[model samples]
Target: MAISNVLMFGMVDFSGLLDKFGIDWHLLLIQSLNFVLVAFLLYRFGFRSVARVMDERREKIELGLKYADDMKREKAAFESSRAQRAESARREAEGIVKSAKDGAKAILEQGKMELQQQSAGMILNAEKEIARRRKKILGDAKAEIGTLVVEVAKSVLASQMTDRDRNNYAAMAEKMLP
Candidate 1:
């Protein structure tokens, strides 16, 4: 029974209810027109300007975000380039040091060669000087021995021969001794 009554109430005519409530159709129509006019004015003057301002703010924010991203990428690139330059410099330094070491080694080897050559030349000069000295000593000794033999022959013949014989013997001795 309650459900039947609720359904019957829902079917009641709305025009009879409006009349009972003292609602006028002309007033309702005028109020509806007023609401529509007010909504259109607010949307045209107030809402449109506010929307424009919001759109401008949104664009600014997007541009700022894009600029920040670009800056971040640039910073990363700069850091990478700096690291590469540092690595290149380190390698160049290593190459320079290696070159210097090689140069030093070459110079050292050249010095050793020169020293060896100088030592060999000195030894050869010393040998030549020793040979010259030995020859000089031998010549002096032979001259000394020849002089002693001539003196001994003169002394031995002086005791056993006459003056002329001794003179001839001395002359022969002198020639034979030489």
Candidate 2:
């Protein structure tokens, strides 16, 4: 029986409750129309415009970030290239300097060797000149001594010899001479 009453209650209509609660359909309909109008106006005039501005700002920020990133990469690459070129120049300069130093050293060594050779040649020439002068002086001295000895011998023989014996001595001396 209780189950039968529960089923009966489920079937009962509750329109009388609204009347008791002082509800008005005309007022409800008007409030509903006002809410729908406010929502439509906010979406059309407020939310859509705010969303559009926010989207523009977001796109600008993204583009700016991309441009900044590209600039940073370019700067880094330029710096690296500059550094590499500088290093290459430094190495080339060092090589040029080293080669110049080596060339100077070789020239100096060659100059020294040439000077030594010239000095040796000069010394040899001086020695040869001295030997030639010595030989000439000795020859002249020998000739002078021979002439003096012959004169002294002639003076001694003139004082000692009679004319008769001197003629015979003269013949012997002449035969002994060149």
Candidate 3:
């Protein structure tokens, strides 16, 4: 097998092709060397610049991620503060409503007291007016009774004088003597 591989390598006939084409092996070797040198130079200069730009882009992406995190925290804080203010406003509104309710209750009580006082005053005035009217009626009735007694006494005296004659008056006068 080694013999056959060596024979195959030797019978390749690359020199005949190069001779027919008037190509120099040494010039080919030099051109190959030049290509390797140009590739190395491009790798050192061009590839390094591209790698630097890529590194800068990666750093900018990291910074943007950090900025986004900070914005999220700020938004959370703003929402918390807004919630606190809303609670405070709700408490204040409740207090105001309670105070208004209390005030209304107080006003209602005061009005009731005033109404009671007015009612009592009116009752007292009515009682006083009724008593005055009763007293006036009694006084008028007593005056009428006194006038009737005086007229009855006068009629009795006139009847007794008309029934008696002058002789009966003298006899009654004698009988009345002590």
Pick the TM-score winner. Answer: 1
Decoy 2 TM-score against native: 0.54
lDDT string for model 2 (117-166, tens) is 99999999999989988877766765555455455556877567566565
Model 2, stretches more than 4 Å misplaced? 1-13, 20-23, 117-178
TM-score of 3: 0.48
lDDT of 3 at 145: 45
- lDDT tens readout by residue for model 1, 4-67: 8887876575657877897998999999999999999999999999999999999999999999
* TM-scores for the candidates: 0.55, 0.54, 0.48
Error of 1 at 4 (Å): 22
- Model 1 stretches astray by more than 4 angstroms: 1-13, 20-22, 126-178
| lDDT tens digits by residue: candidate 3, 59-167 | 9989999999999999999999999999999999999999999999999998888888888888888888888876666555544444443345445565555434434
> lDDT of each prediction vs. the true structure?
0.82, 0.80, 0.75
Per-candidate clashes come to 0, 0, 0
Rank the candidate models, highest lDDT first. 1, 2, 3
